[model samples]
Target: MELLLLEGVTRTIELPDAPPLTILSGVDLAVDAGDRISIVGRSGSGKSTLLNLLGLLDSPSSGRLVFDGQDVASLSSGQRDRLRGRDVGFIFQQFNLLEGRTALENVMTPLLYASGRQFWRRREIASAMLDRVGLSHRLTAMPHKLSGGEQQRVAIARSLVREPRVILADEPTGALDVETGGTVMQLLDEVARSSGAALVTITHDLAIAELASRHFRLDHGVLTPVSVHAAEGLIAVSGPAAGPATDAGEAS
Candidate 1:
C-alpha cells in the first residue's frame, strides 16, 4: 500500500533580473505503509523544500504528486487541507508547541479540526498518546517547564494523536544532546512502528540517517541511494539498489 508517491517533481522560484532558482528538480519517491526512509543532505540542498512537497504544504512547479493513489494536483484546496490534516503528521526540530498551552492541550489541538466523537474525546486520546511517549506526568506542564527531551516527547505525542498514515519528521532530534537524541529517536521509531505509520525523516546527521532501513542522499536537488557501512561508520553511494531510488527522477 503506497501512501505517497512523487514523480519528476520540480519546484522553482522566479527572481527579477535573474534566472529562476530551482529548489528541487525531478525528484521521485514512493512511501509505503510502515516504511522508514531517511534523507540526508547538506545545508541548503533543498531538503526543506522536498519535505514541504511531501507534506502537501506546497505544490511543485512541475511533475506529479500522488497520495493514496490520487493525484494531489487534482484535489481542491479544501480537499487537500482535509487530506493533509487527516492523513499526515509532522514532527519538527523546534517542537512547535504553543507558548501558553499545557502538554495535553497542545496534543489535543489537532483534534479540534476533527469531527464528532474524535473531537469530543480529544482529551482522552491525547492523554493516552502522551502516556505512550512517557509524558503522562507532564500533561499539565507548559513547554517552558519541560526539558528539551520532554518537550520533544510532547511533540511526538501530538504528532501521533491523530494516528496519521504518514509521519514527516524534520530534524526531529537536532536540538538534543547525543544521548537524549538517541533515546528520543528510539521512542519515535517504536511509536511509529506500533501505529503502523510510514516514517520519513530528513536530517544532516549520518548516524541519524542510518536509523532507517532505506537511505538516500540529496545533493544539488538530486537523490541517490546510499549504503551504510555500520562497522566503519561510513556511507557510500550504492547506486539504484532498492526502495524509492529505483524510480528516482533525474535532475533537469
Candidate 2:
C-alpha cells in the first residue's frame, strides 16, 4: 500500500530582487511502507525543498500531499502539527541534540509533549528505544559527552521513541567518517525495516544513497530513479539517465 503520495507538487520562492525560483515543479511520488528511498542532488537542486515538503515543514505552492490515503493539504494547521508529531520522524544532518539533556532525556523529549501517555509509561518506552539503539550505557551521558556516532544514535533513538510511521532523513550520515557513516546507515536500515516504516533519505553522495532500497536523483526540479548498481561508485552525475526512471516528473 502507498504510505505517502505527492501529486503534481510545485514550489516557488520569490527572491529579494530576482525572479521567482522554482524549486520543485509538478513532482509526483508514491512511497510504500518499508520502502527505503533516496533523494540525491547537488547543491540548489531542490532535494531539500522536496524533503521539507514531505516532512510537512514546508507547503507546496500547488498540488497535493497525501499520507496514509488521506489528503494532507486538507488538514488544519493543528491537525497537520499532530500528524507530523505522530506519523513522521526526522533525522537532520546536524545531530540536533540538546546540550544540557542526557541521552535518555533527549530521547524522552517526544513523549514529554505527547498526549495519551502517562509520564512513567513514556519513560519506559523511551528507555527501551534507547536500549534498542545501543545507547543503554550512555543513557545518562550528556550529548556533548558522547562520541559523534553515539550522538547520532541518541538522535535516532529520539526519532524512534514516538513510533512514527515514516522517517525523513536529511544527510543523516554527513558528519561521520566513512566507516561510521556506513554503520549509522545500517542501523537506520535495520530500524526502519524492523518497524515497517517508510524511509526517505536526502543526500548529495551517491555512495550514501546506495544504502537505500530505491535510488533516485533530483536535478533541475526533477526526480529520476537510477540503477542501484550504476550509482555504486560514481561521485558526480549530471544526466537524468543515471537512475532507473528517466521521467523527471514522476515516481511510482
Top-TM-score structure, candidate number = 1
lDDT of each: 0.88, 0.82
All candidates' TM-scores?
A: 0.93, 0.90
The sequence of per-residue lDDT tens digits that candidate 1 reaches over residues 1-252 is 578999999999999999999989899888999999998877888999999999999999999999999999999999999999999999999999998999999999999999998899999999999999998888999999999999999999888889999999999999999899999999999999998999999987667878999987788888777865444555677755544332122210
Give the number of the best model, judged by lDDT. 1
Tens-digit per-residue lDDT, 1-252, candidate 2? 588899999999999999999989889899998888998777788988998889888888999999888898788988888899888999987999999898988999988778776355887888898889898888899988999999899988888888889999999989988898889989988988899989899976567777777877777887765644334344333365443333322221
**Residue ranges of candidate 1 with Cα displaced over 4 Å:** 230-233, 240-252
- Backbone clashes for every candidate come to 0, 4
